[model samples]
Target: MTGNAALTTPESTAPQSPPEEPSVTVSGSPGETRRRAGALLALARFETRELLFQVQILLFFALDLVYVVLQMTLQEGMDDYPVLNQVDRATQPEPLLFAIAVLVCVNAAVLRSRKHGTTQQFDVLAMEPWRRTVAHVLSVVPYAALTALLVAAEYLWEALKPGAIGHGSLGELAIAPLTIMLAGIAGVLLARLVPSGFAPLVFVIAFYMAMVVASDAAAEGKWWGWLSPLVFPAYFPGDPVPADLLGRPAGWHAVYLLGLCAVLACVALLRSGGRTRAVKVVTAVALATTAAGVVGQLPHDKAALEAARRAASETPEKVQSCTEYDGSKYCSFPEWSGVRDDWSAVVDRVQSLAGGKAATTALTVRQRIDTSGGVEADTYIEPATTPGQVTVGTRWGGNRVPEFAVGVATVLVTGTEKSVLQDMCDARMVTIMWLVLGNDPSPAKTFQNVRLDDSTEGSGLLLTPTDGIGMTANQSTVVNELLERPHAEVAARVKEHWTELTSAATTTAQAARLLGVEQPKEAEKCGE
Candidate 1:
């Protein structure tokens, strides 16, 4: 009866079942994966918008504008079209500036939760820690896009200007965006370790200074200098950009930079919570491997860099297009054929002025626009046509006929110098002046302390003229006397003695005597 009463009690009366076992299932599915990816992208977009609103972005634009202004100011006196130079100078500071900007932006974004005392809130969210870190790194894409647009605009503006010469290709243009992304990723990884607001700024500044120093050193061919992002090939005024400057080093550098970004991202990912020790160790090893790969891909020696440049510049398909005029072969790159007509006219005039000596010289004249947008010429007595023929070359900054004429004259008389070399140089200058002025003695009225007869102390020829003052009183007097005579007579005398006048043995005094003009003596001391 007692057992029957116990069975009817509350414990027995309540219906009881077997204890429920917790279901074990996969943590994520396809849909959940998509949702996580979408969340990361959304976070990246949000961070990008926040970054754009910062006052420092405006400061960045201002600094870039200042750089452009400074370049424009400095290019005023340059003889070549300033477009390429302006672009070069304007973009010269890009890597450093963008790196600093991205570093600051990424640091602020990565440390936002901590700075705002929302770490606990962030911890409570179901999102994976690595995804959050990746989102911050992905924010660099938007910044890079905006920067690329601004850079394109700058280049487009230059391209639209009259006489503008565009420099760099689309591939070269990718440098800035890539550099920005690398810097931002690196900054985020650094923030994961340092976590202080000002620390990243200090790091970026120090990095920029180091890059500046390293780039300067790289210009001198130090292999380690190539480690800096700022070490790019540049074209200065009067110097042509080498065809090899945009070659394999660039591609290798891109790979190295991307590998470094990956290593940093992996390191940052490992810093987050919930990663197992095994996962951490595996990631650490990956980071080391990638870092080694980045280093290995770099140009370890100057010779390797040079070889890459040579390969990039090589144009095996380019063939010389030739036109015969006055028994000479005038050859040029096919793309440069547009200047052939003008060059032909100049060659004919020079040959006429030089008379029979040039007619029999079997000259081969080749013209090309060098990588730096400068006019360069190679003139030689063709070996197949003439033995002991001279080879001469000249590079000039502009495309004017006068410059080409001077180059031709300089080439023709290159190796014929004698004891009276200074006198011959003065005579050559006078001859060039006559060809340039073409019976316009009126231009000589604007004269100053022109010292035409003096030789430069070193190997270079002295051709000094400031502003409109290109001649001294003595030079002006001699030029006027020569101009007053009949043009036909002067032409005859020059043609008759062309070879002797170009020879080093012939002094200015001798040439003047041959032309039946009295040579002017040096002016008496001013105070004597």
Candidate 2:
């Protein structure tokens, strides 16, 4: 008999049966072979759950659409600014990204936890071990795929934006997804093997942390910063990444993720001492991988030093042009202007000592725009809003769902308002109204029928004075400060450094309803 009828599981190399000789029936058991085949098939089906990332995929498309719209609406000659601004916005992060992550992780964890609610680990103890284990793993495939898809979509959209370079190449594409894949795989592995909600939660915090670091580095076009892969980890910079510094390519990231999946799967297989050894081996391999990654980046530092030297050789800073200036916006760094080659340490020193907001090169809101052609003078702002229905995308597909509405409208800036006391009073009133209207009905298990409470509603409408509304609980200090400052001075300061107190900027009608006051013509804008 042909012995090729073995190896029932696709991923496994183990033999399934003993072959017979010359038509003599020689087999361990047909039942065992059939069982292994079923398990392998189930595992394949389980992996197909990646299709469900459609929800995250849908959201990816939606966010990209917003990014596109923002990119498009930039005033003529302002394309580069939007892309740069987007780069910066992608850095610090807003709550929206966090919420999306939380939703994906929590939901995945919940699904995994229910199945193994009473064990150190989820015991896939069944007559058909393979099939059950596959099912358990398949459960989190959607979340993992969705997370990966969303990161990819955002990175691609950013790279494709007008004036976006470095993104057109294949090498550019793989860098970012590799990091995201690692992050998502990490989350999936944790949720799968940890058997607690905390696993996914910690994974998400780490994921966001990585993104924050990577995004910050990208904003500056610093090649060395690619190592972070911490917050917003992706290597898809629209710039040429030199070969010397590109040690950890996206392929390595994929290997890392696959290895992670293997480790997590082993957790389900480890029911006894022998299987536990497999876990140890996998853990050791993972640790070794981490060490390798660290070693790979060491040479990057040397490469950066060499590149800096070459740059200095080509364009030596002109020592003569080092004249003094007002140092207000353009500090007296004139001496270092032409002598960049020698001013290596000088450049770092001045930037460090210049102090916040007053630094020679301030990254605050500025009016300079650099693009494909040249620079321009203009201010670009994209009205990015989370629509009523938010779509999430996955590698497999996408899904659109209703969003929890959040908007903030300005009632009045303390100094800019006709009446400081009135702004405060009006803000307080509006806040109370919103709290009542926007009350969450679910926690109380009631429809949106909760009575309007002065306390909660006030909290909702009152935006920070920095933006437009709100004050209370011995509000004398704040009110007095606003009252003391001139309207023009206060308004100017407020406009330049505004932070939203209210998360949800409501419409005029919404604001009106919140205040129980007639709609004021001035408060027409969503964020007055």
Candidate 3:
């Protein structure tokens, strides 16, 4: 019985079997994976809704919307036709105000658990700290997407305008949205590292100050300035270089920004105790990408670019194409080919007022810009030295049309821009002013439009995009009086005394008398 019991013990009675394994459940089973994914989705949705409800975030984004609308409707700059290449860059920084809101709010959201002493509450949750951190980072995506749409709308508003010129850059348009993403992720990273409410404020101040200093350096043409998230070259109004002349490494900058955002994200994940192999690999790749972009943007073949710029500026005739419109020649860069018709219309209107050789004289309206000092320079294009050649700029429409009309009239009256720059303290100034304003439907409005200051009766500088002429107070009064008369009547008098009126030696009183307008009693007479 003892022998039988040894052989047939209870454990071995049924069957010979291996030691029973502990109840092992596979960690990456399909059900567990599904549950994890569902949890992540739920967490991301919750965080996004939370951010959307934040009053400060909604307020700033609303401000952004209102600002964009105002820019399109009430702004004078928008009324002036845009140079597409520069317009994209010009609109890039516009979303930064909204970005600041996202940064601060997102940082606060990430630190909310720690601040409220609910850090332990997440221990029972299905999602880990890193996953929760990822959800917060992702929550910023909707705001970034919204900002992208705003930027697109702003760009399209300008690009679709009748006289928009040049080509827009896709690389440039990508910047604002990427910038939003970067800001959001940066906020999460900052909170993870510092866990302090004041961290966002400190970061914002330091970041803004750095950008200010970097912008100044960029204006000075330092290559290191490309390292900044946004590089705004000192833009002077109405100065736009051709698309090819910009030479901005916008593509690389966009890549750099994207990589930086990824690096920040992965670092945040690592800080949240994710130490995963995948996260480590992504961080390494992101760093490599950022470094490559930096190297790519460090200014290439600058000497060649400068040479090309000089050629485009000093001798545009070689690079420009000529178009014949109604007996006048309009020469412009490749981008302004469509704009020649608009220029021709202004020339036709101005030349129609001339009496002798000034009338029907074929003019060469050469589009010019100074790129030697680069686009950042506040370049004043001096008067064109070529006779019978009037100067026009890349910008058109709005006040630009009338300014161009003034240029055409000056060239027609003085025979060259060189003579227009000479001492014009003479009756010829009255005739030139009459030619510019008399044909306009609103003479006084046109007069105000062409001056630096909107003064109708003062010794002020009369402006054109390319150059300006000074007008005496007496000359202004005479021109104003002539404009008040019937167009047919004044036009006849101007035609009759065309020769004497345009003569530099002619006195203001004699020219005013010829035009049948009262002479000013003020001592500020023409030719003084």
Best by TM-score: 3
- In the range 97-152, model 3's lDDT, one tens digit per residue, is 88888999999899888888999989997678998888888899998899889999
Instruction: Please name the candidate that would achieve the greatest lDDT relative to the true structure.
Output: 3
List lDDT for all candidates, in order.
Answer: 0.54, 0.35, 0.84
Which ranges in model 3 have alpha carbons more than 4 Å from their true place? Answer: 1-25, 77-80, 236-238, 521-528
Candidate 2: misplaced stretches above 4 Å? 1-172, 175-184, 187-194, 206-228, 231-290, 301-528
lDDT, model 1: 0.54
lDDT of 2 by residue, 413-528 (tens): 11122222233433333332222222222312111112122232112223221122333322222222333344444334332332231223443333333323344434222222
Per-residue lDDT over 184-244 for candidate 1, one digit per residue giving the tens place of the 0 to 100 score: 8877887888999888878877887898777666555455676665564433333333323
Candidate 2 achieves a global lDDT of 0.35
Q: Which candidate model has the greater lDDT, 1 or 2?
A: 1
Candidate 1 at 339: error in angstroms? 6.4
Clash total of candidate 3: 1
**TM value for model 2:** 0.37
State model 3's lDDT: 0.84
Candidate 2: worst-modelled 10 consecutive residues by lDDT = 393-402
